[model samples]
Target: MPNLNNVSSPSLWQRIWQGFLTTVGTKQFFRIFAPWVKWLAILASIFLVIGSVWGLAFAPPDYLQGNSYRIIFIHVPAASLAISIYFALAVLGVIFLVWKIKTASLVAQALAPLGFLLCVISLITGSIWAKPTWGTYWVWDARLTSMLILAFLYAGVMALFAAFEHTANRGKAAAILSIVGAVNLPIIKYSVQWWNTLHQGSTFTLTAAPKMSADMWMPLLLMVVGSYLLVATLAIYRTNTLILYRDQGKAWVKEYIRGQNK
Candidate 1:
C-alpha cells in the first residue's frame, strides 16, 4: 500500500553528507568507531614499511643529488604532514570553540606533540640534507624559518594548554592559540616562492605532471600517502586514549572496561 514510486532513494553525496553529520556534534560516533582505529594503524604501518623500503632502495638515485636525494623520502613527507596536521589542529580548534565540543579540543591537544615531533623531524632532516646540498647545516631561509616557527607554535600550544588548570579555560586558550597559529601555515607553504630562499621549489603539484621522472616520484608519492595514513593512525590512537581519559567515569566507558576485563 506504500507509494514506493514517490519515495526517492538518497543520492551518494547525500548519504556521505548524512554520515559526516552523524560523526560530529556528539562524541558517540567516535566512541563507537574507535576500535577500528587500531586496524587503520596496522594498515598504515604496512604502507610506511613498504614505502620506506621502496624509496630508500628501489627508487632511482637523483641525477644531480644522487643518494643524498634519498632523504627526500623522509623530509618531504614529514614536512607535508607537519603542515597538514596543524591545519587539522586549527580546524579542530574552530570546532571546539564554535560547537563547544570537548572531544575536538581533546583531539587537538593530543595532536600537538605529534605535530611538533613531525615538524622537528622535518627540520632535522632538512638540516642533514642541507649539509651536502647547500654546504651549510643551517640557514635563515624563509621556508626553513617559517617551519621552525611552526614547530615553536606547536610547542606554544602544548605549553599554553598545560598552563591552565581548568579544563574549559585550557580548551578556550589553546583553541584561540591554534586558530591564530594557522596564519603561519600559509607562510610556510609559500615561503620558498615568496622569498629568494635556499629551499627548492615544489617538485609536485596537484594539476601538473611531476617535475621528476616517474621512477623517482612514484616512491615519493607512496611515502607521502603512507605518511598521511600514519598521521591519521596516530591521531586516532591518541584521540581514543584521550576519550577514555575524559570519559572514564561515564557508564559506557565503564561498560567498555568491564567488557575488556572479561
Candidate 2:
C-alpha cells in the first residue's frame, strides 16, 4: 500500500466546522458552563431581591394604575422570558437539525419546562393584573389569545418529545414542532398593534425612550436582567445534569462519577 502520511489536511471551513462541533457536541461543553452556574444563581438572587424591593417599595406608582401596575415587575419579565425562551428553542431546533448537535437538543429539552413555567407565570400574573385594569380576569384580545396559544405550543412540544421512545426520533419531532411553532412568535409580538386590543403597546423599545419615567423603568430593567440571569442559571444547571445522566455509560462520565465519589 502507498504511504498515506502526505494526505491533505482538512480545508479551513471543514476545520472550523469540526471545531464548532467539538465545542458544543460533548460533555466538555457542560464542563465549561457548569462552573458559571453557581455564580449566575447567586447574581440572579441578588438582582431579583434588589429589583423586587425597589419596584414594590420605592418606585413611584403609576399615575393611572397606581400601585397595581407594580405587577409589571413580575409580569413583564415572565412574559418576556417566555417568548425569549421559545425563540431560543427555535434557534436550537435549527441547530440540532442542521448540525445534528445532540447537546443542542439536550439544552432545548432542559429549557422547555422552564419556558412553560414562565409562560404560566405570565398568564397568571397578567390575569391578576387584568382584573384591576381591564375589569376582567381574561379576554379574547389578540395579545392575550396569542400568548395563551404560546403556552399551548410549549405544552405540545413537551408532549411530543415525551411521546417518542427513540432518542433521535424524539429530538427530531420536538425540534420540528418547535420550528413550526415559531410562526406564533411574530403574531404574539404584533398582536397589540395589529388589532385594537386591551393589551398595551410595549413599554420598552430599542428605537425610542421608555414611555415611563426613570424611577419606574429602572426597577423594571433590573427585574428583566435578574429574570434572564435566573433562567440562564437554571437552564445551564439543568443541561449539565442532563448531560451527566445521558452520558453515564461513557468513560468520561464514569471518571467524573469516580472523582466525585473520591
- TM-score per prediction, in order, is 0.89, 0.93
Worst 10 residues of 2 by lDDT: 161-170
Predictions in order: lDDT: 0.86, 0.92
- Candidate 2's C-alpha runs over 4 A off are 1-16, 165-167
Overall local distance difference test of candidate 2:
0.92
Candidate 2 lDDT, tens digit per residue, 57-163? 99998999999999999999999999999999999999999978889988999999999999999999999999999999999999989899999999988888788
Each model's backbone clash number: 0, 0
Q: After superposition, how far is residue 219 of candidate 1 from its true place, in Å?
A: 1.0
In Å, residue 185's CA in model 1 sits off its true spot by 1.2
RMSD (Cα, Å) for all candidates, in order, is 4.0, 2.6
Error of 2 at 101 (Å): 0.5
Q: Which residue segments of model 1 deviate by more than 4 Å? A: 1-22, 25-27
Sequence-dependent TM-score of model 1? 0.89
